[model samples]
Target: MNPALQGLLTIIIGVGGCVGYFYFSNQFLDKVLFPASGPNAGKNINRANIIRPWLFLLPALLALGVYLAYPVVETLRLSLTERLPDGGSAFVGLDNYEQMLDEPKFWEALKNNMLWLLIVPALSTAFGLLAAQLSDRVFWGNLAKSLIFMPMAISFVGAAVIWKLVYDARPIDQDQIGVLNALYIFFGGDSPNNWLTIPFWNNILLMIVLVWIQTGFAMVILSAALRGIPEETVEAAIIDGASPFQVFFKIKVPQIMGTIVVVWTTITITVLKVFDIVFAMTNGQWETQVLANYMYDKLFRSHDWGVGSASAMIIMLLVMPILIWNVYNARKEMQ
Candidate 1:
């Protein structure tokens, strides 16, 4: 079968099925369940109207249940069960969690994730705010914003590949191709250093990649938030003898603090789920393990599904609070 033809047929069938289902369901609801030709027609019509929205929402709800809710429940179940030699499993509650907790690598991954949580969101948000402010002041602000926000378009792995080259190293005798080592040699440093192998510093270096990508996202959001600030407030502050810095910090920043928190939590969620850059650049070597990559290593490399699922649950637990907070803030803003 032709691939394009198959795709077209799939699309046609999907659309046809949806249209047919909705048409028939509404017919059943109107003619059979709530016939308009009866004594209770008005009540039936009212009830049908009430249920109509749910009919529209049913497909999406079912999708979320199947795709989103199912995996979480299955992962939790897997986390609680141990695999047996006969391809069966035994329930071993908390044993996987205990083993994961006891592993030094798991602790290292957790520590690194904490470090990422602390550093990446803060730096990304700060840099984004700074860029937003500075770009607005410049004559070529849009162009500047475009350049700064460009990294957001790149995939994490692609950005890792790019920065990987920037941090690449070679022997002293050969010409340095990496931007960092070239500058190092230009400044008369003796040997080229492998920037991704320096343990704690390597973690910082990997974080810079994420920060670079996320800063663009932060900038775009914070920029809109900054623009949404009332000009009257700025003018009033300036007229009241507030210095530019004071006006920005005291007036503008306070107005956008909600946005700032949203951006911070948004990036924090991304940080907790971070895996690609670490996997691509260092593969969690040099004591730079993160929970997602550590889970991947366990689930795939070591074939340890129970422990892997346990780690996954841990990541979900860590992310849930911030997720809830973010949702709360969003609802408050809507109200």
Candidate 2:
């Protein structure tokens, strides 16, 4: 069979199968669960009709269980077992957890992760808001928005590769190589510094990459929010002798505070799970490891499934509170 024809036939069959299944299921359910609900009890209670949409939700729930719930349970179980030499395992309860607490490298990774959480969201949101506010007062606002949002179009791995070249270090005696170090040397600095090898500064540099990528997302969201601010509010504030700063902080900010929190919390979760940039740039070397990097190292490099799982679980534990808060904030906004 022609490959294109085969693929088209497969898709047609799959879609037809789904349609048939749903139709049969709905008919069976209506006959079994909603057979007039004791005709004497109801002339026509609309209750059964209201539940038709829910009949279609079972497949989604099953998919969620297989993809999300099972792995989580398995990871938690793996965290308690030590990977034995012969591909078997030894159950060592809480040893991995205890070791993780005492390990200096773990602490360093945590510190870097914390720094990421602290810096990226604030800087991204600030830069985003600044760009958003500035874009509104311009003739080329769409152009400006496109430029600011361009970074988001790049994949994380691609962005990391681009920055790797930008931060690349070469011999000082040779022509300056990396863009940043080139500028540094042009300013009379002695040597091309290995920006990825420095301790705290490398973390900051990594944070800059995330901020660069996420600022575009922030800008797109916040630009909309800023535009949504009622002009009357700004005019009213100005009529009351309020300055631009006052109108921004007191009037515009108050209305958009929920969106800001949502953006912050959303990025905070990403920061917690960040592995690619650190992994690509430094491979969790030079104390620049975050939780995600640490998890990768434990699982793949050291082959310690237990510790890796514990590390992953710890990351999950840390992220849950923020996730709950984000949900609460979202609900409040909806209300």
Candidate 3:
């Protein structure tokens, strides 16, 4: 077999299996095990109804445990142990953590990741909000939103390839190719600069890729939130001698703050795990290392499972607070 065919068959089998299980289990409960025609029919039916939901949910919970919870637990265990030279593993406690903390590259990646966490979510949200607000006023609002939101559909590697070309640099003697370099030369600059090779600025250029892709997601969500706002509120604000800026900032924005925070936290998670753009464009070279790429390098290139898993745990720790807050909000909403 073909790999694609095998995958298709596997998916078909999985779905068929789940459907068969549900149908047969429900039939068994209703007809054979707990017949609705029995003397205790009403009690049996109520019990069956309660148990049926769990029967359906059991497979999902098992899958989650096996696929998600298992890996996290295993990774934590691996992070606490180091592989010996003969391919044997030994418990090392916090040695891996100490080793990672000692590396300057890890620290560099940590700093860059922090900066990314701070900047990407904020900028992406801002650009998204601006696009959402402006596009709503235009006659071709849907078309504009479509164009703006189009980037979100592009894969990270594809987006990286597109941006790499945009940031490409050719010699001044030859025809300039990169847009930035071309613009630079056109405005009377020195030479075509390789943007990705530069230090802090290169990271900025890499971040711009994520920002571009994320802006559309932010825009679509915020646009919906904005649409949900009552027109009467805006009219009331206007009647009270409020400027457009005042209406947007004071009235509209306050109403949509929840959506904005949701967007922010959502993008924050993406930024924490951002790997593809940096990997495709720079590969964490020239002081541009981020936690994800660093973990990748440690796991594969250096063949250090201990350090890689430790880095993963760090990423998980960073993400935990947001997860808690989201769960808290969800529970509160339920109440």
Candidate 4:
């Protein structure tokens, strides 16, 4: 068979199989097993209802287990083992982690990532809240929101590329094409500075990209939460002589604290897994290393799976709290 035809057939069969499974499972439960019109009709129907959701969820659960759960387990195993010369693996326990800890670059990456975790979410949320409030009061609010929200739709790599020009450096002799340097020179600065080559500050510059992208996401979500605020509450705040700032920070914010936490954690997770921007901009140079970029370097660049997995596990550990919170929130909301 042609490869394309084979792939099409495979997809058809897989989808057909899932549909058939659900359809027949229901048929068996209702007709053969339950027979809901019988003397025990009520009990049979109750049993079928209890089983039905799990049956429908079976495929998704299976896929999640095999793809997500299994890879996680396998990566953990790899983190604890060293690949040997003859294609075998030997358990090295915490040796890989020790190796990573001993390295200066790993330490740098860790510190930088911690800084990113602290700054990105806070800044993104702040900017988002500002945009949300401002847009709400503007005549062309939707247009303003759309333009600000545009960055969220951009891929990280694309955003990185876009900002590359913004941070670009040129020799002192040539005209600076970068927006930052041009403004600096136009203001009578000595020379164009290479933004990404500056330590500590470079990390901040790189962070600007993530913030630019995530702020829009935060804006849209917080905007919705802001809109959902009861008009009566705002009226009451005004009646009490509360200032606009006080009304927003005290009345409006407290009401949407849960949504704010949701947005913060969501961005926090994104920051933990950040790589493409760093990769595209500085590639972890100039002390701008982040965990994800560090992990990629170890895994693929250095071909050291053990240390790589250990770094990945570190990221996973950092993400766990937010992940747990999200899961808890989702379950609570469901209830």
Candidate 5:
């Protein structure tokens, strides 16, 4: 079948089904169950009215149950079971969790993820706030913002590929191609450094990729928050002998602090789930392992479903608090 025809048929069937269901359900409630013209009609009508909203909501609730809730429950189940050689799963309780804790690589990945959680969101938000402030003061501000934000349009793997070349290494005797090596040699360095191969610093280098991508997102959001600040507050600060820095930090930042926090937590969630950059650049080699890649390595490469699911649960646990906090803040603001 033609793709467009299939899509059109899907739309027609979906809409028609929804319409038919609602109409028929309402008729059944009024004519059969509720019986609007009969005795006890008022009570029946009240009952139907109360149940109507849930009827509309039932499809969505079921969809969420199937898609979102099921995966979490299934993953939790998988985490607690050992994959047997006979294509069966045997319940092993917390053995997977214990084994994961015993592994040095798991600890290393957790440590690197902690480093990412600490660095990426903070650096991205700081850079974004700085750029948001500075860009507004420049004549070519929009163009500058565009240039800064261009990296956000690039995929993580694409950005990794781009930076991979920038960090690329050539032998000392050959003409250097990598930007870092070329600069190093120009400054009288003896040998070209393979930047990604260095352990602790390599993690920082990989994090720079995510920071570069996320800064623009932070900037755009922070920029809007900045613009929304009342001019009178800034003017009042300036009139009271406050310096530019004082006005910005004391007035503007306090006002947009909520927005700043939202951006930070948003990026933090991204950092926790970071995988592609590490996967593409180092494949979690050179001590740059993050939780997502760690989970992938366990689940796919090692074919250890139990340990892999445990790692996944750990990542979810880390993210859940931040997710809940973000939603809480949003609801508070709405209220």
Candidate 6:
């Protein structure tokens, strides 16, 4: 078949299949469900009423099941087996989980993940809130916001490389190479330090990379949320003698609590799954490993599929609740 005709046929069939499914499902629901459950027991029925909205929903539901639900199930199943070197394997029920629990590297990665979870979201949201509040009053606020948000446009690997140069170091005898170390030397510091080799602090340094990338996202969303806050509410608070700080705390924060949660949760999820920066900069070497990088090490570097899948499952398990809460909160807000 000609490519154009094939494409046309595919679209026609796709639309026909969707229309057919929605028409049948809507009929089934109205006949079986509404008669028994809905208040309209004796209402007139029409095909237009039955299938109008579901026509749009059919494609989305199908895509969700195909792209999201099926892969999750496959990943869960993959988590339970070990793949061997000679293309052979055996079932290992929780053995991978046991190994992961016993590994120091896994624990370190988990610890770093915890640190990321604690630090990045809080810092990003705090800084975003402050930026939002400050920008609200500035004359050229849009320009300032554009500048602040520009970092978010850089790829994670690019950002990591940029920061890598900033954190780069030279021997104390020689000139300090890294921007940070150079700044220190300029300030009369004695020696240059290897920033990435520093434990715990290195984790914080890695987190600053994420915060740099995500703060712009947080700022954009939060600034919009702040702008959405009604002038009447601020005026009312002022009329009742609320100080600026008091009004901000009691009124503004409470009003945008949903957006705050959203920003925090979004960054938290990103932090949990972070791999690119760590891999690009540290390659999970030194003390800079995170959960996603840990999983990558097991899956690819070590060829330990079971352990990798298990860690992937763990990440999914950690993220599912936040995702569920996000959905619930969004629904509640919409209602």
Better of 3 and 6 by TM-score: 3
Q: For this target, which candidate reaches the highest TM-score against the unseen true structure?
A: 3
Candidate 4 displacement at residue 224 in angstroms = 1.4
* Model 2 per-residue lDDT tens digits across residues 1-33: 999999999999989978987898887756666
The reply for model 5, stretches above 4 Å from the true place, is 1-48, 330-335
Error of 4 at 308 (Å): 0.9
How many residue pairs collide in each prediction?
0, 0, 0, 0, 0, 0
**Taking the tens digit of each residue's C-alpha lDDT, what string does model 3 give over 132-251?**
999999899999999989998999999999999999998779998788889988999999899999999999999999999999999999999999999999999999999999999999
**Per-residue error (Å), model 4, residue 73:** 2.3
Give every collision pair in model 6: none
Q: Would you list the clashing residue pairs of candidate 3?
A: none
Candidates in order have lDDT scores of 0.95, 0.86, 0.95, 0.93, 0.93, 0.87
Could you tell me every candidate's TM-score relative to the true structure? 0.94, 0.86, 0.96, 0.89, 0.88, 0.80
**Taking the tens digit of each residue's C-alpha lDDT, what string does model 1 give over 190-220?**
8999989988999999999999999999999
Q: Assess the local accuracy of residue 316 in candidate 5 as a C-alpha lDDT between 0 and 100.
A: 91
Report clash pairs, candidate 2: none
Q: After superposition, which runs of candidate 2 have C-alpha atoms over 4 Å from their true positions? A: 1-17, 27-54, 83-91, 329-335
Instruction: State model 6's lDDT.
Output: 0.87
Write model 6 residue lDDT over 62-130, tens digit each, in one string: 899999999899878778878877987778788889989999999888888988899999999999999
- lDDT per residue for candidate 4 within 1-335, as digits (tens), equals 99999999999998999889999998998998888997999999999899889988998999999999998999999999999999999999999999999999999999999999999999999999999999999799999999989998899999999999999989999988899999989899998999889899999999999999999999999999999999999999999999999999999999999889889988998999999999998999889999999999998999999999999999989988877877887799899
Can you give the lDDT of residue 242 in candidate 3? 100
Residue-level lDDT tens digits of model 5 in 174-214: 99888988998999988999999999999999999999999
